[model samples]
Target: MRIALNARILQAPRTGIGHYVAELSQALSCDAQLELDFFHGWGWSRQLPAAALPGYNKWTTLAKQVPGAYSLRRQLDQYRFTRGVSRHAADLYHEPSLWPLEFAGPMVMTLHDLTHVHYPQTQPRDRLAEIDRRVGPAVERARFILADSQFVANEIRQHYGVAAERIKVAPLGYAERFRPREAHALRACLAQFGLQPGGYLLCVGTLEPRKNLAQALRAHALLPEALRRRFPLLIAGMPGWRDANLAPELQKALASGAVRLLGYQPDEALAELLAGARMLLFPSLYEGFGLPVLEAMASGVPVLLTARTSLQEVAGPAGVYLEPGDDQGWCAAIQRLLGDQPEWQARRTVGLQRAQEFSWKRCASITASVYRQALE
Candidate 1:
């Protein structure tokens, strides 16, 4: 059957949803029974290679020089797809982002999280509205929906008044980049990135309000001075909006040598860093699924994640859990994880086992099944 995938998010770096689309698409393309067609918007776009596609290519160009044109270009792309989908007559169209609609065909949208729904304050009102408009239609028209986690599925059911039966829960997969590393190799990698081998508590994801990075810094500051020395907070993420005030506080923390902000870690370097870190601390306020928790566990690194939301779901028995907003809670958790080597090693073992349960190939296979279901 012919498949049209809404693969726009694959354009992102190694963040959660982006990684999901990029890896899973490559996996699905491996199946010879399926014919894959993908669409990309925004001029000057390029897709990284995914070998599974039997008959796959992109429609893009470098020249979109139309003046103040990004917005105009995006709208045009939307209209193009509105027209394109009807004529393409794809057996199914899979939208990777939330509320993936505005096309004329059997479509399936992947809702990554309920952050925008649960914490609308985390996203700009105007941007949320734009998303609401696009996704709103998709929710109503799509034959089925895909959610990265059950946490997000429930949110869709509640907010959109969509039944649970209409949505399928398919969690994202972990990358192989997250694997055990030699201590010497880990330090060598960090040295290249100007990262001290041991002076950090790592958190990887976009620097945004939902990530609760500001609160993480504050929690670290509240730690007793002696406890702070072994693990200075290290945040790795690209900057995102609705989080303007956050950067400055991170700046102050950086200036004081209390925090390290390594913006947009190159994938290989990030993999090494994940393997080398004292612990992966993810106290994000919310998530559709927690990719970092899986990454950390896969890397043989113990994790400290928020007890609430999907982090708990993703981390399962492999991680140490604490409340995201509880300053004292993070302080206590971080202290123990850093000081107790035996505890760390024990958790790492369980984490590795749990991490093994998720794989890109499985994600692809299940997604293909979802696609087939949509077609039926």
Candidate 2:
């Protein structure tokens, strides 16, 4: 079967969805039964673009500030997509993001989360408006829908009334790179950032309101002065929307040297970062599937996460859970985990076993089946 996929997300620095697309595309390509063509916004190609073009981030940021820029860009993208579709015929088109382009073929879409719907204030006005306008119609247009977890699958049924049969829960997987590393092997990579193995706590995600990082910073600050000084909280991600709102608290944390912001580490560096951490702290308010939790688990690190949304599903029984709003609870949990070596070791062992259950190869196998089911 010939498959046309929207690969436009790869044009930017990879976050959750971009990694999904990149990893899934590579896995799907290995399937002998499939012929894949990627629609890279303005053109079609068989090979995926390796990385973001130089200056694409600056250009996108600038474009978002200009009036009517998004609409104009969308129109041009549609024109190019329509023209590309006419030239390269395919049996199905799969959209790995919320908004799928208009397609008259069998369509498959991956709804990563309902964040825009559930937390409207988390999004910028224009982006939220665009999602509000497009997502419902896109859901209606898709023949089959992919959700990252059962939590999000239920959200789809509740919010959009999409039937359970039509929606498939295809959990994501960690890349092979996210495995445990020895202290000796990780020391050099960690040294580059003045980090040491098992010497720092990590929180990995874009800096956004939905990530609830301010809460994490607060919890870290509540640690005893010596504890905070010994194990600094390391945040690894790019600056995202509404990050300025976090300034007051973030500034205080940084001033005390209890928090370090390492913006958007590359995959190689990030994997080492994850593997060397004392533990991974992820207190996201919501998630479709908390990929960072899975990645941390895969790296044989204990995870402390919010006790809500798809985080529980991703972490299984391996995570140390706390409520998002409970600052005192978060502080206590961190203290207990730091002091209890046996508990940490047990969690790490179970996390490694749990990580073994997920892989990109399995995800691709299931996705291929979904494609065939859509055709039927």
Local accuracy by lDDT, each model: 0.74, 0.90
lDDT of 1 by residue, 1-376 (tens): 7777666555544466667777887788789988666665432122443333222222212222234243344578687666656656677778787645355557777778777666766554545666666667668787778887788888889888897888888777877788988777777777765666555788888877778877788888888877666577888887775567786777777887878878888778888888888788887877778888888889888888777777777888988887757888888777877788788789989998998888888878877888888778
lDDT of 2: 0.90
Model 1 stretches astray by more than 4 angstroms: 12-14, 42-74, 82-89, 99-101, 122-126, 196-199, 247-249
Off by over 4 Å in 2: none
Cα-based lDDT at residue 58, candidate 2:
82
| Cα misplacement distance, residue 113 of candidate 2 (Å) | 0.3
Reference-based TM-score of each model: 0.87, 0.97
Report the lDDT tens digits of candidate 2 across residue range 1-376: 9999999998998889999999998898899999999999869999998898678888677766876676677788889988888888888999999778888889999999998887888665666677888999999989989999999999999999998999998889999899999899998898987878999999999999989999889999999999999999999999988899899999999998889999999888999999999999998988999999999999999999988989888888899888888999999988888999999899999999998888888889989999999999
Model 2: ten consecutive residues of lowest lDDT: 122-131
